[model samples]
Target: MRFYTLFFSLFIFSCSEVVKEESFGDVTTQQPSIIPAIQVYASNTDTDVKNGILYYKDTPYSGVYIVKFKNDRIKSKSQYLKGIKEGCTNKWYADGKKFEQRYYSNGHKVGVHTGWWNSGAKKFSYHFNDLGQYQGSLTEWYNNGQVFREFNYVNGRENGAQKAWKANGNIKANYEVVNGERYGLIGLKKCFTVKKGQDKVTR
Candidate 1:
């Protein structure tokens, strides 16, 4: 009788331990670490983060994808975005010149996209439509960094003149745009004679 009682007690304790472990596993499996709103992935791949990389999958049965950078610049950092060639995409230099864009539901480019510098200068800016057409003002800049002027676009064609200036503040350009075509005169700002023995006015 004594032996049987001792055996029963041991069995009960063993069952309790098993139950505790099962419950722990269930809780850990069902609940993941929560991420804040407006922030993208907080936990990726379930693998430990190391060497400035975090990986995740677009779906349970999808190919693994990754986000990589020099260090913890995750917000400014960009990735393949959702394991598709689509979604908010950004490309950048290590020194931080970047081209960033977003796409529509059908994977067509959309909205105001930009190329920028870490110094916050706008290198170029373009607006696009759902069909990936350039449908807005497209601006470019001089190397010394002035507005080289902008041309209005429609269906990826230039529909207006691009007026711009030189680094010396003189109007040095007049460009007509049509379907990425640039034609017409480039203002060289030359001095011209209006009358004899009179000083030349540069135009």
Candidate 2:
């Protein structure tokens, strides 16, 4: 009788252990699975310039638009609202380095726009107004980190001094614009002819 009792207890304990393991497995299986975020591609979208909007399968798009390189890396991403670019836009090089960044509002560029060379050096910097016209200083740099060009703009036209330099730091073009006229020298021999609306130099 003691042997039978011992056997019965051992069977009950083994069954309880199996029940606990099965209960743990059931909980793990009932847990939710992770889901990835969705991405929209520009190529899959259609532009409607006349309506001033973008469409995806005939529906107005109001999310982030993405452009990717052939290698599946993100090339550019821009925010859109009601089919128009309405926020920050960023671009990246194939090697994953940032190439450019700019802001837009109501489909027009606003604020600062900047670009960088593949070598991680600043390439250019520009500013724009709400009207999408150039405003403030515009500067460009060579890949070797030398200043290449500098100009001031007011209302989309160059106003004030404009300067350009060679990669070796020598002056290439030095001029000034006042009231829609250019003055000073370009290169070594070319002279600027001041015309009513002309801003370029003639040899």
Candidate 3:
């Protein structure tokens, strides 16, 4: 399990100038292809095991990859260099619905990232800069396709009015965050305000 999780620690950087921070914990170093002749995994075939590890192959990588499930279903795919995910990474649900679509460069998430419900409806969409810090606007929707939450971020920290809507489309909550401080209604009411302390926020 630890080894499996290692591949995913792939995203880490400060909200501000994340790309400048680089280094995140123990990075996964690319292992040179030692068994190039080994057949890559095929969805229609049995699971391929190598050295007690699950199926993995180096199929003329050329800086791109498309992963698959044992059933021949596409699982996830991405482009990367030196073990760092670059360009676009895409994944799908077992049912064939897109689950996640994101962009990255040099291991730091950049551009837009989107997710969808199993039913194929957009679930959430957000933007991040080349540094991997949340920027611009972010929004999420209920499974029913109703707006769930809307907010703005700056350097990964909430920096503007944030609003949430109930499934009925009614405003549920509202607030504003500045430099990590929260201010506005404690609940959905239009009145009342509070100020919370500050702390670093991340995606």
- Each prediction's Cα lDDT score? 0.50, 0.74, 0.64
- Give the winner by TM-score: 2
Better of 2 and 3 by TM-score: 2
lDDT (Cα, tens digit) per residue for candidate 1, span 1-203: 99999999999877555421111101221211121112244444453333333334323221223344556433242222233333344555555445444433234667777765556577778888777888878877655677766768888776777765555445555668666668755555345322322223344
RMSD of each: 15.3, 17.0, 15.1
lDDT (10s digit) by residue, model 3, range 1-203: 88767655644222222322121112222333321212233342433434422333532222445567666777776655544555667788876667888877767898888998999899999999879999999999999999898899988888889887778676666778877888864254345332322222212
- The digit string of per-residue lDDT tens for model 2 on 1-203 reads 99999999999877555521111101221211111123478667364434767776676677667888988888988767667876667899998888998878788999999999999899999999999999999999999999998999999999999988778776777788999999885554545333323445554
Cα lDDT for residue 201, model 3?
A: 22
Name the regions of candidate 3 deviating beyond 4 angstroms.
Answer: 1-62, 188-203
| Model 2 misplacement above 4 A | 1-39, 43-52, 190-203
Per-residue lDDT value at 144 in model 3 = 94
Cα error, residue 97 of model 3, in Å, equals 2.4
Error of 1 at 192 (Å): 8.7
Clashing pairs in 3: 43-72
* Better candidate by lDDT, 2 or 3: 2
